[model samples]
Target chain A: MGDISKKDRIITAALKLFSENGYHKTTVSQIANQAEVAKGTVYWYFDSKKELFQAIILTGIQRLASKIENRIKEEDDIIEKIKLIVMIYLEFFDKGRQYFRMFQEGMLAVIDDNFKNKLMDFRTKQAEFIAKIIEQGKKEEKIRLDVDSKDMAYLLLTMLTSFNSHLHYDNDFNIISKKDTIINIFLQGISR
Target chain B: MGDISKKDRIITAALKLFSENGYHKTTVSQIANQAEVAKGTVYWYFDSKKELFQAIILTGIQRLASKIENRIKEEDDIIEKIKLIVMIYLEFFDKGRQYFRMFQEGMLAVIDDNFKNKLMDFRTKQAEFIAKIIEQGKKEEKIRLDVDSKDMAYLLLTMLTSFNSHLHYDNDFNIISKKDTIINIFLQGISR
Candidate 1:
């Protein structure tokens, strides 16, 4: 807590309060108190609560993008790279379910047009990241050449997104342990 | 429209208005006007707008379940049955995007506990239906035996659900032509 910057502290506190009490009910004063900063300090970093909430979402998306980029760069085999992509998604959601919930709220809640546009932009960028991986897989001859990389990327992403919805209903279902099994099904069709 | 029952008329108008203007913005009188029925007549059928909204959701779910049940029975091949399930899902969403939006809104919006529990029940029943199909596929050697039927069902359902989200982002993406492509990717996966 001592090492964390005031900006980081505010953002962290905002995410917790927003997720727990929801966006409208959560106040900047509450965020300031949680972050151990003065009410005015929250404004020092963000102009408004809406801006702070948007920052929380953008930060999480950027963090995910960087993690996927770095992890996939560490792998060479196309199939292995794809598996890594799937595993990263599961791990991200499984570990950051709260942040994921925040993101969903940000998307669904009545946010400003600018915030809505940013959310949509993040979705497009995420799909593009996966599309790039599928493109690489196709070039390596590991994935089918017949399928459109973009569509396949969307499909893969859709599967992962659906996994989030599934987890919402069955929280007890262990996604972490099913990681390999999930990847296996994605990698090699479920057919014998 | 004339042949439709009063209850059906009320539900239909409510669904459209709710999907378009949102739940809170939509009023009972507006629904009554749209249905060409008296304001009191609307309440004669549904106790509240919430009840009417729940009825719309339940009707959609029941219709989908029955469609899947009847369609699967006509197909003997387990794989075909599963494919039929996928096609039916896409068709349902495509034809009923408004209703789907209502369902999503119902899910994201703050609703009564009864509505929330009903939504959860519909989701569980959906996964169970898909699981039954996967179990049959395994028995016929159409699908792999190593994977858990429930997990696989959830996975397939996840893929379709993702498709809906994808549609939200890229409305131009033609899911109909990509049906085989998507089903192919799901059944055989994207691997070469």
Candidate 2:
């Protein structure tokens, strides 16, 4: 019981199973065997499969949120802050490929309604953060004020969602690229 | 027997089965029974289930494409052309609610690889059509050529996908209702 780190062990096992069989088919016993932990041990850390799955999503979102918060905390300018978001979001999925897979597949037709609600709430926060950026840019005369920030934020989020296809199947279909194409497009789009 | 209409019989049965259960679950027997036709009669026109589904998608896509084509056909300016596309796309989805449901629940994930490829190709044509509008806009000095036409088309598509959530959910979900608000944001962005 005291021999191993439970949480890390659980996440590692869950990731493998989720990647292989998808979230729906994989069960606690399989994860327990892979983690080399007892069945009770897995349940102790995660009450159910849905909780474990939610944990994965929450961890990914929180990680992204914290990273974004830390990056923007250093900058006072709105434009610079927005730049960090574009780069960080792309990088986060790049680094956490499994999370990206889970994010896309689970986000589409996942079982948990509450988790989806949480996701929608997180999306609101992300949009709010973008709106604030647009507001600041407007105040500084770098952005147009006539247009609403909320809608624009939704636009950016959609672009980000499609951007996942780039990571998943870059050669077959891409949402962004190594040419810094998206970054340039955003800058050209907003440059006053 | 002669009074049984062909178009109404096939589609009415299809929409019922596809919506009630799903595309994959509903079989040809049920469809033929509902249509008051033999299985061979259903096969005579459709060839197979995949072909039938393709026929359904074709019906939707053609209807949308022709309407956009006709609306923009009279306009000389590219700005007017793009506006027509946006208007047509949103209006069609609004009015054609059943087709929209079929479209949103696209059989990309559940179908055979060959069938999925055909569907994806059809989608690519849509993106190409959008890119052509942007390309024409560039020639007309309406949009910048520096940004890739395909990418910009994708941008508009992405925005539409995100905004669709607002339509389905009762909550505004932070997206504004005003079309001009959205159009202005797309046209001018946050930048002054």
Candidate 3:
């Protein structure tokens, strides 16, 4: 339990620094100092800085996935389920703005192939989750059968992430209104 | 005339290098060598590397804007004009994949406040341009009157960019089919 706590501390500290600075600029030494652990302990806990960064991202993705799973477990309506999912995402990123920033940095940075592959895998899995919901919507006759579920899921997720980033940049925007707009547009589009 | 050619060569070489190796990794000396000009020539044309990058982005945006304007000048139908705009964008990026790559890098990198602000300005202008189209559609009774044109435009542009980046990473995907899917989703959505 102590080891787990220590590792968590390192991750928490590293995430703050990485998000505040950047992946390339943040050093393991700074993470160790912030976490109040010796530099050697940092190395003992993780093989390298890259590994530590990967661990932070993995933990974030897992946590978010579990949260969404728990929130939507009782919801049967496809449209309601999607709304709940979007709300969960907005609230998740709102609280974990640092994590969102780190994720954005990870997305854009020409990091190593391994890191890039991992990010892509995360996105693919995310889209797959939404695609399954879309498929369920189709089965329930709530969604259009002509459109490809996977493609729609991908585009929907893309819009969600993009909107989330916009929220991060501008604080004056109302989240509830924006969320409704997104849902409305996704379901009905802009055409009369 | 000779000086203009030299400057153009430098910009071309810098764009290639910056896209291949990121903005941070590519040096002015390397750009000069690639352009077959003296290192001092690069500095004479631009104040700094950042300025050079800004110039490339500005030039790309202007060129794209002109092409889009020229193509849609005679088209009276809003939907057809939108199709033309999207096609022009796809073709522009397809021909200048290097510029698109550099733009992505610029979007993600925390180079400086000036650079970030400039990118945001470019996006805002693009969104505004799309917003005008949405307004025209609404007037034509082709678009829903309830939606905010600016917000809708912003979302539409975001999806276009996200899809463009996806194309950059994947080669097997059919551009025409994806373009159709995007337009269909934007206009009709996925609901039954």
Identify the candidate with maximal lDDT. Answer: 1
Estimate every model's Cα lDDT from 0 to 1: 0.74, 0.65, 0.73
Better of 1 and 2 by TM-score: 1
Tens digit of lDDT per residue, candidate 3, span A1-192? 446588778988999998777675778889999999999999998998878888888788788888888878899888888888888877776777667666544444445678667666777887888889989888888888887888877766655654555444444444555667767776774223
- What does DockQ come to for candidate 3? 0.32
Considering the two chains of model 1, state its CAPRI-style docking category: acceptable
Which lDDT tens digits does candidate 1 get at residues A82-173?
78888888889888776665554444445567766776777678889888877877776677777778877766776776566545545556
Name the lDDT value of residue B69 in candidate 2.
69
Please provide, for model 3 over B1-192, each residue's C-alpha lDDT reduced to its tens digit, 9 standing for 90 to 100. 446599889998998998776676788899999999999999999998878988887788878877777778889998887777777776776677656665654444435677656656777787888899879988888877887888877766655554555444444444555667667766774223
TM per candidate comes to: 0.81, 0.72, 0.83
Residues A1-192, candidate 2: write the lDDT tens digits.
676587789888998887555554577899998998998988899888768877887877888988887888898887777777888887776666556655444433443577768777887888898888887788898876656677667666655654553343222444435325565556545546
Candidate 2 residue B30 Cα shift, in angstroms, is: 11
The positional error of residue A188 in candidate 1, measured at the CA in angstroms, is: 1.0
Q: Which residues of candidate 1, in runs, are more than 4 Å off? A: A1-10, A21-50, A111-117, A190-192, B1-9, B24-49, B108-117, B189-192
Q: What is the TM-score of chain A in candidate 1?
A: 0.84
User: Can you list the residue pairs that collide in candidate 1?
Assistant: none
Model 1 reproduced share of reference interface contacts = 0.40
Best by DockQ: 1
CAPRI quality of model 3: acceptable
